[model samples]
Target: MVWGLRLFPRAGGVDELALDRALSAVDGPVRAAFALQLLEGLDESGVRELLAEAAVADPVGAMRRAARLGRPDRAGAQAMLRSGEFDPCTVQTRPSDLLRRRHRVRAAAVAAALCVVAGGLAVAVEQGARGGGEERSPAGVFAPVLDPAELMRTAAERWADTSRVDFTAWPARGGRTDDDGLLGRALRAWAEPSESVRVSTTPGTASVPPAEPPQLLFADEVDGAAVVLFHDSADRVVRYAEPLSGAGGAAIDFARTDDADVTTGAAVVVSRTADGARFLLAPWIAESTTRDLLAPDTPGRPLEVGPDGVTAEVPRPGAGGACETWPVLQLRSSERIVEKHAFLLTDLGELAPTHLTYMPKPGRGTPARQPREATGPDALVAWARTACSLRTLAGSGVRSVNNWAFAEQKLPEGGASADWVCTRADTWRGPGRVLVQFLAPAASPADPATVIADRDDTALCSKFGQHVLAGTHWRADSGRWYVLGAGSRAVTGIRATGEVRGAAGGPTLAVRAPRDADVELTASLREGGTLTAVH
Candidate 1:
């Protein structure tokens, strides 16, 4: 709350005395009512969430209002009340419900009441959702609510050790990045580890600073591994390096839809691949491009993100192509777009992200109008599927990116730890299964038995079973398959299911493979089923 005094000062009126009075009565419905008045200083979504989640006493009534009037709008809520649902004076619910809807509204009842009593004074908690633009001083800024990307990144770093980093120095040309979004941020923590990783548009470079500067967003280590924050003018990483982590860190990656001009300031972008790939580790600055990335015929500027959540104009991608605005996700090995649902990372510190359904799609999308922030990965996936009419088989971008599925034993995974990544079309038609057992684990002593594979439905047989070990059965069905016997422990981590429909006959589908292994799939249709192997 460094810049708190400046950013939050009662947006409507409460000029100090009016504020203090409200601080005393914070709690229950009265507290929420006051907090509602003070919400003007907060982000739009944060306010909406507060009303939706908080126990307003008449929850069922409020929900009815929400259904009829949409949400929080007094007119709508009043209209809904006509149907005999609520009274802001009596909106209440169970404590357990508070837990379930915590993300919606979990403001301290006491604090909210006090703030309201103080006129329109916003409590500090009310101003918690600020992102970028509003702050004048670095200290004055508030970290945007814990977004899905940052939270996931933190989790990934913790479980897989991507956080262990070195802050020996900052790169000369490195600095804060403008390329940022609800997904994640990029920063350069130290001097480029090697000269080969260095680059400069002006053709000359210099040594970076050596100090624990405030500008450095964060620096940490996990399992002895290191990651440093890079900025446009202050980071030490001299050049962007490939293979950010030798082997262990290959699993962690970052991306967002960057269909904008890459030529100037910061912009968020999703990637095609991430393993050992070169990226804008820190922030930098340069000229600005006047082109929009969404135009199909537009030749856009090529820019990259910097450390302080900024972007810098750079030359075109080495292999030139029109940089169109897409809702993409980029990893070292590949990149894809958020074509389906826009999943906003939550501040709850949990893994379950929320999907915002703004457009027409399957039963999943919600037709709610929302804030204009750009889209995220979930949205892009759905979009790609619908646009391309991708079937049970892999989609175009996934095939090109060469997505893989790791062995069944991957741990602490979710956009980190180099685990198997498979983005399936939610509405695929046939049976989908990853090969549980490679056909020849004994014959070939190469790698694990798990390989990225699709079930080969050789329209012939139906009940296919093989004994991996006595009592452990590998069964395949026309629609479902089991890696272990019926009573076996659930394979929680193994990405076992995929859609499998196409002409009944077996089709060699795309799936990750353990270095060198043979995978087998079995399925049935009107023509029965058969088993087959893939290298």
Candidate 2:
């Protein structure tokens, strides 16, 4: 199926290959009529009229004869008819007009080919399009296609016209889908003239040179945010770059390198916040392969430093030398301090690395705090409760009884009791200092949840590595408490009755009970911690 179009097979007839060959043998006008009837959804009268105007007699009959000769079966014929290459609207002119248009298209194609030939004659061309080389067209004598310079210029014009832009390192590998929410904010800031916005381009910084000739790069800056886009001669986006926010820093200097280097790679994002400069070195490997490298106790000690402002280095963890060790830099001073840093091994390849750094405005600085370890059951429970509360606020519910909340609550020991129960438990941790888990009903299950929050609130959860819950609701049967919700990060707040407040300045949670209801709140604290009831 091409572009979601499928053709049916004929019974005991020639295969698609034979049908294609036969179709190629037909006259151009007859083929055009067939395409119009099949692909463009044109009526028989329309096809006949167009063919008559072109002085082609028995146009419908001729198409039928061609189909029969090709033996394409109904399906194969349909595939040929539906091919996007032919458009019936363009064929509505007189026969002479049609011929002239075709000639013009072919001439344009030939001119492009001649330009490529001229470029080739001047110097040795690389395997792929690079260094002033012309890109050869696979389709000969067809239509005009944009060169790399034209594509870049068009993209830059488009970028300047829009307030928002998204950049991804590996667009073809689904990296484009991972929106970090910074692009929107940057766009908004750019709309205001008072805001600091810069637009420029960097040469030879992309991880992978364009696979096609005429690679182009465009860069834009909004305040402290920076965005870079890489395009090929065909105007296709090959890579994107943007700075990310990091803890203890004004902005994170980071870039996604193409897999052309090593299979496993490391990334260091340096971001500046109001507090100070923050650096985060994370492994760009896959989650399953990051167990050892991202372990909580894994040592991230600096390997080396130099006079060129380079501070530390972490070797790739895998056995192969197919990976490059990334350096994690730390900046420390007496008054201002760097907050936290981490590194992990990840699975990613393709796209070259482009480095970027955004320094916070000199006078705009806030006091920095030392990073603290959030260990113990209290901390775990706090994290779990915050996660659950966010889930509840967002309207998400429990999916299965085999979740962390159920195990932590010891609900299985109750022998399938029908009592309403709520549990919050820890789940997993990301490469950085972020932890993830779930909270839900210990008995009655509900549908997947959704969160309703404004953009800024939603961004909070994303920056902190928290997946918000949505569709969460509180229901009570007898004196038992039951909460239902789903998993997501779009949750903003809960619209429920009661005074909801954040615990330890975390996510806001609230629960209301009837006057006579016996309410109990407890936590399993670890060493040097205490569980207290807030009455």
Candidate 3:
């Protein structure tokens, strides 16, 4: 497996025949990851040499070959990649500052799904595109829990409607149980959730935020006319600036202009429903820009509408370097309304009135830690006696599916920054789930930012989990969070001790709940107090 090659040396211990079989069923990162085992024999010094050469290699194929064999040749490196064995369409940049940045596990996967299907496939056509972006875990936050009872559910007949088919080819979908994954594995450590009825939890009533009226955010158009609207059931929209767009009902027409970018200077219109649905209306971008719909449309039309009203796209996205959340306006042709979605426009470059972008952040930029040759985890050594959840398993199942990427980052006592490369994820298993792996970096004077790559010395999640198994070592807090898995079909958390860390360096709270109970833990090395929870 690519992972085996990255961790252990190619000296032995891997089953080449098994990997070859795996290659047939999977592609993208998983494939490339498994291919890593072949390169493991090299020492730290040898691996470093290969990365250097691979960096400046001329032919892409050469890189693939070397990366595959661990010799690190550019041609070989690209070859392994070209095999469609990995995420071919992954947005690529030098693996420079990757170690320093914190990853947004779920966000990266979502964005990758979009980029891969579009970007990767395009490359395949020419060379053909093969595959796919941020993750944010703001500090001083509480863990989130899923209250299935709260999820709206209809009769059993409604559940049956989930499929267009009457029977499934494989097993039934159920709870998660995979230790390699952050959440999948954690489920085993917690308790079971409860089966309850639906009752919307208002922030005030649930002890989340104070109560208020749910607010409308945006709406999107479907096909041509149907509009989909989004709202904050607890009126949390204004607090987070969740974008709202669909405003669907628009009949925009072109005036036989040669170019598509022209727009009229006509005034824009917006409306909202009492139930928290919003609408945005405006004359075509061409009309708003040139003040003449009849003008040439070659260059591009300006976004005559934005957040603050529509002065050349108001609400001004955001400050530089930070992620700028924007609305993805899916139009029908040059100016027709289709539907819309939220995205982060990395930069406010020259995007057309209808074009979209995503959030950006400030920084000189850090690179991801380039995963070196490694052996597959010990789990791959043995297969599960029975595949528990079809939902949790992929076409190839866990071991054969996602070939793990490994690296180590040491946040020493004094603390130094290190870079870690994170590719956007193409798929996310659990809903609203964020899997975190506590890395045990080898002792080094170099701050995290300077740690470019992982030496074979780093350990696996289970191996290094001891650091956190007792509890988070750094200063932190606790709150109501949830865990989902089958061992018990529930997840329970507790008020363990927390430490000091983050921008404020204060005691933070943490929480985990399995439908039946809530576990809250808060600790501050500085300001200490025992947390008490009543069953």
Q: What does candidate 2's lDDT look like per residue over 1-535, in tens digits? A: 3332334343222454565644564557657776776667788788888877877744644554434443425665676445433323332221335446678889999999999998986556454446655554322112112222223223322322333222222221112212324322222222221223322112123223334332223333322445433334322233233444432222111122322211112222222333222222221221111212112233334333322122132222222212122221222211111123222222111122211111111121343222222222322222222322221111011111111111111122232322111222111111111112333333212211122221211122222422333222344444444332222212223232233322211122334434334333323222222232221
- Indicate whether candidate 2 or candidate 3 has the larger TM-score: 2
> Taking the tens digit of each residue's C-alpha lDDT, what string does model 3 give over 1-535?
3321222222212333333443554334333333433334444344445544545222222223233333334344444444433443543323333443345556688888999899866655644232211222211112222211111222323222333211111111112111113221111112121222111211122213213222221222222232211122331211111112434222211111012221111121122222211223222212222111111112223444443222332332222222222221222212222122111111111111222111111122343222221111221111011111111122211111111222222333334422122111111111111122222232421111111111111222222311111122222123333321100001122234223222211212222333334223322222232222111
Which parts of model 3 have CA positions greater than 4 angstroms off? 1-18, 21-40, 56-342, 345-535
lDDT of each: 0.25, 0.30, 0.24
Give the poorly placed runs of model 2, Cα more than 4 Å off. Answer: 1-96, 99-535
Q: Report each candidate's C-alpha RMSD, comma-separated, in the order given.
A: 23.8, 22.8, 28.0
User: What's model 3's lDDT at 306?
Assistant: 46
Candidate 3 lands at a TM-score of: 0.19
The Cα RMSD in angstroms, rounded to one decimal, for candidate 2 relative to the true structure is 22.8
- In TM-score terms, which candidate is top? 2
| Candidate numbers sorted by TM-score from highest down | 2, 1, 3
> Candidate 1 lDDT, tens digit per residue, 1-535?
3321222222222323333333332224333443343333444354456655763443322222223222235453334333322223443232334344545455666667876877544434344555423533221233322221221122212212222222212222222122232012222212222333322211012334223332333333222233333322232222221233554322222111112111111222111222211122212222222222122133334435443323332222111112222222221100121223221111000011111121211121333222222233333332322221111122111111111121122111121211122222111112223222232112222222222233232211112322111001232323233232110011111122323221212221223323223333433322333322221
User: How well does candidate 1 score on lDDT at residue 3?
Assistant: 22
TM-score, every prediction: 0.20, 0.23, 0.19
